[model samples]
Target: MTDQPPTLPTSMRAGRILGPGHTVVVDVPVPTPGPGDVLIEVARAGICGTDLHILDGDYELARFPMTPGHEFAGVVVALGEGVRRSALGQRVTADPNLPCGLCPECQRGRANQCHDLAVVGVTRDGAFAPYVVVPERVVVPIGELSFAAGALVEPLACVVWGLERVRVRAGDHALVFGAGPMGCLLIQALKASGAARVAVVDLAPSRLALARSLGADLAVTPDELAALADVAPLGFELVVEATGVPSVLEGAVEHARPGGTVWVFGVAAGDAMARISPYTLFRRDLALMGTFAVNQTVPQAVALIQGGAVDVEPLVSHVLPIDAFAEGLRLAAHDPTRMKIQFSFGDASS
Candidate 1:
């Protein structure tokens, strides 16, 4: 990144998700930056559950043999036609969502809710390569932000959106089920946004321990809820079920205080169903809110990471080379210790 290189090779090394249970590393054409686009030299890319879904062909919009990566940070290498900015050598991160401008949702300024939404990593080539072409509008400057923290902005943006619909008052007691990467981020985000204390529940002790290390007021297994009656005798004011499991979704409402809000923020299977009593919902006057991905929260997410308000550093447990991206997938699937496994495309590190 020292000297601004005039040009790069025609082809570059990249990781491609061929189909269900298939991945390959190969040399592919560096995508041509289109009008109002910027070519990025990928520094790091993070692996998440959605990546697996895309790889397994579970995402309806995903096509076969695609370079799969959504969360990434990089340096601007070149600018496309109609782009007047001097983006070369600038560090940056971008939102992966591509909402159709013609959609009603987009017209209403709710692009995340667009009916014809197309995600970069899911429906098109992403940053798990030496270079990727992204629209200039989605790109956000990562001033003094490390590539590792910058890559986390995408997920943090989603967390910000989750809280946008759910109320988080000062001194509010919160309970979060599922201490995975998103869950952990939710914990920090809640604290930063003014929640008094957060009790985390997860099946794994390691994840719970991480929750505690990250300033969670309480970290306990789901089975230990009975023992925590004295701590939140009435139940939490805010209940978030981060695990996409339907069973967890069904039972999470029970952990919310009467009239308290419940945020169903996880991505459950399209066909998945969680039974909640309509009678109870009416009787308790409880509010059940559903939040989708990030919408206009990228800048705040970037600020949070760069300002050290949310630490995703601990979440990145594995930092492997781009050549081992396939192996990174295996670890993401099987490794419980792995909170976030990222591919280092160049000099990127954990």
Candidate 2:
């Protein structure tokens, strides 16, 4: 398709307005890519918890009336002038957060902390629509990978970034709290990083079961952890709190072995507080840290998926058509049995 192809519809269908407001199918403009940008025909878009927050206006940095889907895979249909990095009909997934390379954080090699970060689906329009415009630098080619798997690169990259911060070592025992999409991805990453045994905890039996299929050595419901006390009496060497629940954070601290690190990757709601013993933190030498969105780990995440080190297929529980966007979001929000729900633009068989 050329830049000046037939005049497309001015508005397209999308699932929008997440948290306080109900997300319904709405008509939105088909965006245009400016200079140094490329227009993508979104093939598949993944639903994340962040989208739920956006609906509620709970996201601190989000703007209203926005389409809220960041994780996506699409094909390039048009390129703005001076954009030479990408061509038409290329299959790719984009880094949702586009950082300015000349910013202070970028100069310091911490582009993730850039002051001028433009995140798709949050501050700007995103892939929930039929078309999205993004910087050429943000798109990464996926070669022959399926569009569904390509959409997962965003969360996988975030997991990779969190793993980098934790500095996992071989033979370490890891306990991941929450067997959601992020939790499952972390379990796979931990195993690939040489962790001896990775245990996953979640309330959902289906999610726990999927975690097992994704390489978790031990998968248990939150209520079942008491039974495994005989197997891991001293707790695990590393604790990852992937569930944003306050009680889960406290449990991570309580279940961690002395001197073990705790990595908090989930986005706990604003004003939500967790009570912890300062004495325990001081005397036990426990490390408590939080990891935000991904930085520069997209390439590494791609390499892991491309090399077959991580299997993302089992995590994709549902695939809905773009017209059913509202139904997809509702199913993702209310259904405990669902793990990951994706929206597709073209044929489902594709």
Candidate 3:
């Protein structure tokens, strides 16, 4: 008799998209790991604004009927042959962007610019399910970090990359536009990178409070920004725009001091564009830069979390089960009181 294929979990619970416009909870097959791959039993998945955009068909590069989750952490349950580097049962976080190492950008040490970048949850099925298959290289060992904290590594890595690109300096005053999770993370990173004072702007009161608790020296609303300008006429030395809104980018330029640097870290919509005064750009001698997803900052972020230099727990405001992913998305999208919403696996036992 011919040997049958090894039995795997027949059905896995996942949050699936029914069409380009809708999402629902459904049962899907648990994927099998292939060569140079590792199967992760997702313990926690973080909901991000990008996930909301993906659900609303606002992100131009997303695939429909996709399981939408990219920021995640879990335990490695299976490894394909030739994957002797990582052991099973190890706690880990995943790098969502899978790049072809042989691509021109990758060959030039700019993996974030890879031409064939396949983002988990965006281009393919991702960690919204109980199990996800990821390439071995994209998996990073998290050691003993909690699943929730580990889930933030991916986002934190992106923040670290942006921070490095901006090259913040000691005693520099930074103006952070937005008080959401990413903005809060940037606040902490700016402080850690030696900024003397950091100011945050957001419309949400709760988020502004959280930003203060996380190290923001000042948290102000949009309306209050003008009053703040009275204190610093030329505005801040470094302006970090975390709000993806185009208007915020324009405001960031307005608030930046002469000869200051503005780092645009937010991911705006595909068609969105920020308007700037070319004359002001030349007269102010301002340096404007944009940072994309991480290239080599994952390990640095992990180390900062592990060494207790940056706190991730305060940023995680909600933890729900995977079945409640839609609820999580809604909360992340509508609830200003919430910071980071994470999906947990099982009844907290797993």
Compared with the true structure, what per-residue lDDT tens digits does model 1 show for residues 6-54? 5677898899988888899999987778888888988889997888777
Residues 135-205, candidate 3: write the lDDT tens digits: 88889999989888898898899998888778887888899988888998888888888988889999989
Ranking by lDDT: 1, 2, 3
Best by lDDT: 1
How does each model score on lDDT?
0.85, 0.84, 0.84
Candidate 2 per-residue lDDT over residues 1-350, each given as its tens digit: 33634555667887777446666677777777788899888888999998877776788768876787899988888888789889888988899998888989989988888888879999888988778888998889988888888989999999988888888889888999989889999999999998888998988888988898888888998778884455467777789999889989997887777888888888788879998888888888899988888888887888899999998877898988777877887887788778889988854225
Q: What is the alpha-carbon lDDT of model 2 when measured against the actual structure?
A: 0.84
lDDT of 3: 0.84
Q: List the residue pairs that clash in candidate 1.
A: none
In candidate 2, stretches whose alpha carbon ends up further than 4 angstroms from where it belongs are 1-4, 7-11, 227-233
Ranked candidates (TM-score, high to low) = 1, 2, 3
